[model samples]
Target: MQEGCIEWKLDEKENINSLEELARHGARVMLRIALNDEIKEFMEKGETLRDEEGRRLVYRNGYHREREIQTGIGPIKVKQPRVDSRKAEVKFNSKILPKYMRRTESIDAFIPILYLNGVSTGDFSEVMEGLLGKGKGVSANTVVRLKAEWEKEYAEWRKRDLSAKRYCYIWADGIYLKHRDEEDEKSCILVVIGVNENGDKEFLAIDSGIRESALSWKEVLLGLRERGMEEPKLAIGDGGMGFWSALREVYPQTREQRCWVHKTANVLNQLPKKLHPMAKKMLQEIYLSPDKAQAERGIGRFVNVFEDKYPKAVKSLTKDAEELLTFYDFPAAHFQHIRTTNPIESSFSTIRLRTKKMRNCGNRKTTLAMLYKLSQQVEKGWRKLRGFKEIPYVLEGMPYLDGSRMENAVV
Candidate 1:
């Protein structure tokens, strides 16, 4: 054995512990090494010990320290350790322990934690510190700590989930926000949510666009089909010609359900503030009517009552009456779910609120990664939302679903 060097056998745990003890036996080595903020994080988190595969090895709490000195034989080899895991915690706090600390093995603890609080990065940091603090490896700048893993995961996620599968219904729309990428131009984010056979909604894809153009929406929808989505039974969206064109290009047979909420918003925008209540009442009669015939009658009543005073509003309402009530054709049971794209809208609100803190995205990939992380958060707590329970009953006369028919339907 060299006088000032340490070596160990791979099979000897006792020797390893003894070596650790020897390193920390005397004066504590408190050498500070410069590292990128991220590497420093690994030291801070007690995640410094990693396997050859780069996966973190838990329960090993030792960090490497290096020193150079002029010795009899030039620069002598020196490696020392200060504080390691063998030291018992001098103190403990029951109230300070983070709940997420227990799930150390999970690679995705951040998602569920952030989702619970309904906050973005800054808020996410505050909530974590508020609950857990520094002891559990919680940091104020968590996104910086998570950059490497997030990048890797985002890349893998983009390439992994590919399938040319069909959906029963897909809700598609865009959320606009001001992102100061190169300049503070209005940017639109495209989101698509697919409804599967069991009436479960799954997020399919999201993309950013300068303007909600036909070209951009078409690219997004085309990318979806290219990734895995096949023909859809229906595609619900705001009645943008671009959205319709994109849907048509992707799934020729899919039914189009113009978002009722957006159309109503357009109607209400034209009315004066005081007249909104009356306008809403008139619009409700059209939308709430049980059948197309009754809805038409309601529309007639609305026009007769408001046309002279609010010709523009009446004309807009009458123009969109058919598209607004398309949900009625798809069985009364499915009406509530299909009338608007509220599910996707709610999901967007979370993402927007989270990212809006930053003036601009770091880059396109980071923007996408943030959105993906937020979506994963939503999915973590998501329950299978109950759809039209009477769907089977509503379609009773339709040929009974045999095994082959059912298989074909899903495919």
Candidate 2:
């Protein structure tokens, strides 16, 4: 083949920008078809809705009103057809478009993502207008109403029954938002994510911290118990979370596992900057050991090396020694998955970023609702736990040695 000037294929008549307009038109047409079909089915071939006696029951009234429905593509003007029935109890209602709906459910969902992205309520119209169309976006008041709706959803989710659920692992975290005025020093959101027996992760709880941390965490655990959540097999969190105390009180049988990542950070914070790299590597060695016995040995090594110079760092390292090594008691394959609260952190990374940029989350209800909405969306993308098959053995309380069942261990 000889090199030559290339000619690209392009259709001069086909304007890509017009595709949206064509789609909008198509949506309107389809909406009419569906509405008409609903009416035809309601009235049937009888010309007017009637009973077997041929008595008139329903007749087309008229369009309720022409209104604009905000959608992801753009706003489309729609006319919801109406009908009146001879029976006072009968009426025509469009399932396709409810009487009070002004926007698509997708639009309702999109607003919160924007809100989480640090878009203020006042900025919603301008931002949506640019994404939607100049004259087709929702108002700030609409955003306010959506907030009320989300609060209701959060309220309902908080009260949901969890009695039939059993989780193999649960991760807990307390997230403190940076506020505008730095109002409450203790304000934080306590989040819990659980891994069910099927190895699927799900949100178990998201509650705003109440008063004393021990009491607040206790309340969260007690709430889970009340809602029928059986005690999880393992609970992973940072050592400092008052969650451990609450866990002991609420589910005494559940095992505790301190996050190695948080543990490393806590220990390093006590050591000199010059020694951080070495100290961190030693901490990693302890947690990354092949088995519990070696892990305990690694801890002893870490202590012997640093106890004289960095007693504080060694103290932090040894204080939660048992919890840090708890991952070894489970299947080897699950060590990576359960050793840290990374699952929880990664899930809320976006929300944390947005919430950090926001000076004030308004109120506890608003903040919780906003976080809940984002999590609801985030949960859809979660993958089943790795080594999910090993969950059954753990649930059965079988003894694990070096990440293998005792029976499966070599002689």
Highest lDDT: which candidate? 2
Off by over 4 Å in 1: 1-128, 134-137, 140-142, 159-165, 183-185, 350-362, 388-411
Tell me which residue pairs clash in candidate 1: 163-228, 164-228, 165-230
C-alpha lDDT (0 to 100) for residue 38 of candidate 2? 86
TM-score of each: 0.62, 0.76
- lDDT for predicted candidate 2 compared with the true structure: 0.82
Candidate 1 structure quality by residue, lDDT tens digits, 1-411: 989654443434324345434443221221122122333444466666556787654442353444432211122223432233322542111221222222222324454334323344555545554443333333546555565566677667655544634366788888765443564355677888876655667778767775778899888878877777667666788867888887777778777777877877887887788988987887777777767778888888878987888888787777767767666656555666777888788876754675555544444545556666667667666655355343343233222121111323332
The per-model lDDT (C-alpha) reads: 0.59, 0.82
Candidate 2 per-residue C-alpha lDDT over 1-411 given as tens digits, one digit per residue, 9 for 90 to 100: 348732333245534368887777767777887888988887774365568899788888787889988888898888878877878777767788888888787777678767755677898889898989886667999889989999999999999998776789999998876433345533878999999888889888889885428889999999999999988889999986578889999999999999998988888899888998888888788778887888899899989999998899889988888888888888998999999999888977776777666644555667778878877877888989998999988888888878988976443
Off by over 4 Å in 2: 1-110, 116-118, 179-186, 408-411
Worst 10-residue stretch by lDDT in candidate 1? 396-405
Candidate 2 TM-score, true structure as reference = 0.76
Count of backbone clashes, every candidate in sequence: 3, 1
